[model samples]
Target: MIYIYLYRLPPNSLPRMNKVILVTGANSGIGLALCERLLCQDRQIQLCLACRNMQRAEAARSALLVSHSDAQISILRLDVGSTQSVLKAAREVKQRYNRLDYLYLNAGIMPNPQVDFKALFKGLFSRNVIHMFATAEGLLTQQDRVNPDGLQEVFATNLFGHFLLVRELEPLLCQPGHTAQLIWTSSSNARRSAFSLDDIQHHKGVEPYSSSKYASDLLSLALNRHYNSQGVFSSVICPGLVMTNLTYGILPSFFWTLIMPVMWLIRVFTNTFTLTPYNGAEALSWLFLQKPESLDPLAKYHSLTSGFGNNYTQPRKMDMDEDMSEALYKQLLELESNVRKKIEEEEQDTRAHGQYLNQTE
Candidate 1:
């Protein structure tokens, strides 16, 4: 059930020159936490909760309004995995908002995540245990499928759909004298080795989520090269190992609850275990306060927690180069064109079949 809540503010109700921010997957987890933090930081900004589930979106909006009675919040149905949904939501955004300030590409999926207990047991004794737990390298796998748009599920949801939205909204983002920022919620599990230009969709790979995040890192750099001159900046962030629904998928909540003490102990050695969603949203909330122009194109911002539980944002140079980023950008453009053409052909065929049926009748 897709529902578009029309709570558009009257002319006088609009905040004086307030920024309009859109967050995808703003219903729960890190996305929802980021929204709460943003509203707390600036009461005047207009927020649009673009989510796949309308009920959850409405609930999230209501909860936010409880603390922020004067804030302007709207909801739109957006399933980033679907081509039709992305197009419709982009249209809605352009229609409803005069300008877009920050576009958070935070909606993603790790469908049917299965953790390898065998590898987990071996990693427990290895010197690379910290890295293993941090990256989940060979320990996690997800079941992915093909979407209606004829792309791999994880690729379409995490990367391709967001790519299309940016392209579609380029008019609002890439202006002559204004600036807009694209912030992606990447993960510590993002690995360079998991991604392959040859198998960009990871149709035969096990770590599609990691592959998607790495692609996002490359795409952010490529976007800087392509659109930085047009006044649009892109950055990536890692929320560390947050125990959100995504993490709950890795290990059951009860099991995680039992191991909470162990995780807290391990947090001393590797602050990547930013266990709470609020702590996970630290970098995302920090990025909102930054001057987009001053950010590094190749650096990935991280949300880190200390042994004392202090939160801070840190920027680390990604293991990507300009050449590879450019290559990825070109490839994405090609795929975008191809996918559009394919969908057009399908629509035409459906129309032709309908016409033939009507003629016979």
Candidate 2:
């Protein structure tokens, strides 16, 4: 269930003196690790955890407080897959903060993921073993379904929801003389062929996760083109191969248990096998401290862990074109209009149903 908060601040409460950083999916994995790293780096940040699960969000807040007792933190319920949820959360954000310094679009999912072990085993014998491990190219797929809003679940969660959030927060993010950043947790699996302009939702593809991530890269560029002059800069990052709940779903627990030794060995060749969430969050944490102008708008920052366990960030150019990115952006706007119309209609129907129930009672 979504968490709700009444707007109340104590007279003794202090205003935020440091950056206001908001992270979606902030309760676990890379998102949680990134939060911890941020607080460790600076105790003054006003951190907001935008999560669908309030219980987990509170648990994560308690954990962060344990590490830094005086760190500022708040919670908001946001399910990026739902239009009503996103709209509600956006409204609450405007009420909660005066400015949004950093927006981390870090929430995403890989549903019903399947790994092609036959190809995985075959790739182990090939010269591109390192490439296979780094990109998971042709090695993974996921089942996709329609959300309640009649949009592709993976697409809605990973890309479109954040797109709407940015649009809603424009007054805070795109104002003159005020700069804000949009940092996304894109993936190494994002491929050129995985995404299609005509099928932006990837409804016909098994790799909807990959398609959505690739779309994120394009959308970042589109955002830069449209909003940079307005002071909102957009960037994307790849957390490499982090072993999180998402990863656990890709293969069974026993399979991962059996491959622990092999994975560590493979880590020697490709540092993308960062494995641990903290190690995987290097680039995300790094970007938190950067000047937006210093980052490449078209590059996907990767978190890499060395064979000896040191973590670092690297930026690699993404395979994207401005023409395609702009086209995709326009399509997203059109889809946005359609969804908003549907949502308004749904709300009217919901109220009508409530009235009928009341009359019957």
Candidate 3:
């Protein structure tokens, strides 16, 4: 990964007056880092840090205020793994900001990973392999149970929930004059082999996290194709590997500590492993300053850092299939419609009961 600065902002000249940006997974890691950097660049930008834990969100806000006292930062509780939470979060955003300028979909998970280091080493030495797919690619993992939405937790959180949120907020997102941009925090770990049209949810013994991320990358491409003409542009980026809290939890603490030195050495060769949260967040921050039409909607951006720590964005080869993306899109549409109908029916039932009681009174 080479540090190629596609574009850069002059200074504190970010157009913050008319832009209200909302970022999911903003309590910590790359999400929080992006929020901080974006705010420093332009304190006038209103940033909504969407997180599941209100307490953590408050803590993050307090920390941001230490340096950026005038930054307009707020929190909206959201859990991308849950459909109910998604709808509730969207309603809150709509109530707060009538028009959204940028929506950074960065909430994701990789639970209970079981990576075969033997296979990894073998692949590393193989003729076809250039580097170890240690960060986000060529990894396999399983998460917890299916969500209340009756979808795999990974798929629901990483893709479906975000999809529902975008659909619900379409009115605000599709504002005229290139007003809105959807940036998906995708990964190089997203492999085409992990995804199957016959089993998009990974109900079988498949790795849900990798499959879901790949689905998301494809979905992002499909979204740009379907919605770009309507003023909504979608882009995906693979933030080269970073040592985040989420990654630290995947393996044993002792192992991570012991391997810290080796990790540093690896960083020298693999520029994709940005090594710090700040560098890992460069793609999201870069997208914030980019003009809508200048962005390549179909290409997945790679956030890379040079050996000397300069941040840049590189265009990565995305394995996108329109037919598969369309199939997944239709399936999600049906699922969203069904869930909305069920919620509406429940509301109607409560209303009917109230009316009957009123009549009896």
Evaluate residue 202 in candidate 1 and report its C-alpha lDDT on the 0 to 100 scale: 95
Single out the weakest 10-residue window by summed lDDT for candidate 2.
11-20
TM-scores of the candidates in the order shown: 0.93, 0.92, 0.89
User: RMSD (Cα, Å) of candidate 2?
Assistant: 7.8
The local lDDT score (0 to 100) that residue 201 gets in candidate 1 is: 91
Residue-level lDDT for 296 in candidate 2: 88
| lDDT, residue 48, candidate 3 | 93
Report the candidate with higher TM-score, 1 versus 3: 1
lDDT of 1 at 229: 91
- Candidate 1, 157-193: lDDT as tens digits: 9999999999999878877778999999998888999
Residue pairs with backbone atoms closer than 3 Å in model 2 (clashes): none
Cα lDDT listed for each candidate:
0.91, 0.92, 0.83
Quality of model 3 by C-alpha lDDT: 0.83
RMSD of each: 7.6, 7.8, 8.2
Best candidate per lDDT, number? 2
Roughly what TM-score does model 1 have, to 2 decimal places? 0.93
